[model samples]
Target: MTLEASVVHGDWEYQPVRLPRDVTRLNATAELGLRSRFGGWELARTLLYADGTRKVWLRRKLSRMREGAAV
Candidate 1:
C-alpha cells in the first residue's frame, strides 16, 4: 500500500510519503483479532476525509499466501 500527499494551494505539489508496514500488522492483530491467524491482508474499504485525505481498511484470512510467492 502507498500514500500520496499534496498541497491544496500555492504550488499544489504532490509527494509520496512512506508509512510503516507494521500498521497492517497492528490492525490485523489488534482490530481484526488475527494476530496468530492471518498471513496477509486485503483492502476492505476506503474513506475520504474532509481534508482531502483518505483512510483505508484491510482484512485477511488465516491461511492465505502472499502474491508472487514461490510454490
Candidate 2:
C-alpha cells in the first residue's frame, strides 16, 4: 500500500492512510479515534504516523459497530 499526505497548516501535513495489501480498511471512525488515542504520539513524526493510523483504526471500529448493531 502507498501512503499519501497533504500539507494542511503551519508545518503540519495531513497524511492520507493507505492500508497494506494484506490489510483490511475499517469503516469506523470511532474505532479510529480510539486507536489513534491509544497509539499516542508526542512528536511531529509520531503525530504524522498516528494521524494515518487513526483513519484505519476508526474505519475498522465503525465497521464492527455496524455489524454488532445489525445482529
Candidate 3:
C-alpha cells in the first residue's frame, strides 16, 4: 500500500509523505498540519464526504457472553 498527498499554496507546490498503513497514532506535527497548515484538507474532506469511508474495525456479533454483560 502506498500513500499519497499533495497541496498547493499560492502557486507553491507541496507534497507530503504519508504512511502506507493505518495510522496507529498522530503526532503533534501531523495534527497541526492537518488542522491548519494545509489547504488540501478541505478538498480531501469534500471528496470523502461525498463517498462514504469504511470504519477500520467493528465486530459483527458476539459468540459468547461473559458475566454481567449485555448482548
Q: With candidate 1 superimposed using the best TM-score fit, by how many Å does residue 2's alpha carbon deviate from the native?
A: 11
Clashing pairs in 1: none
Report the number of backbone clashes for model 3: 0
In model 1, where do residues sit more than 4 Å from their true spots?
Answer: 1-39, 63-71
Judged by whole-model lDDT over C-alpha atoms, candidate 3 comes out at: 0.32
Q: Write the per-residue lDDT of candidate 3 for residues 1-71, one digit (tens) a residue.
A: 12244433443333333332343335523643563444332212211123332122111222234212632
TM-score of each: 0.32, 0.24, 0.21
Candidate of highest lDDT = 1
User: Candidate 1 versus the native: TM-score?
Assistant: 0.32
Across 1-71, the per-residue lDDT of candidate 1 in tens digits comes to: 36554222232222233334445545534643442245244455566556554455544432224222413
Model 2 segments more than 4 A misplaced: 9-12, 25-35, 38-71
lDDT of each: 0.41, 0.38, 0.32
Name the lDDT value of residue 6 in candidate 2.
35
| Candidate 2 residue-wise lDDT, 1-71, digit = tens | 34454334433334445443344345333434554677431123322244344322112223444446646
Better of 1 and 3 by lDDT: 1
What's model 2's lDDT at 71?
A: 65
Error of 2 at 60 (Å): 19
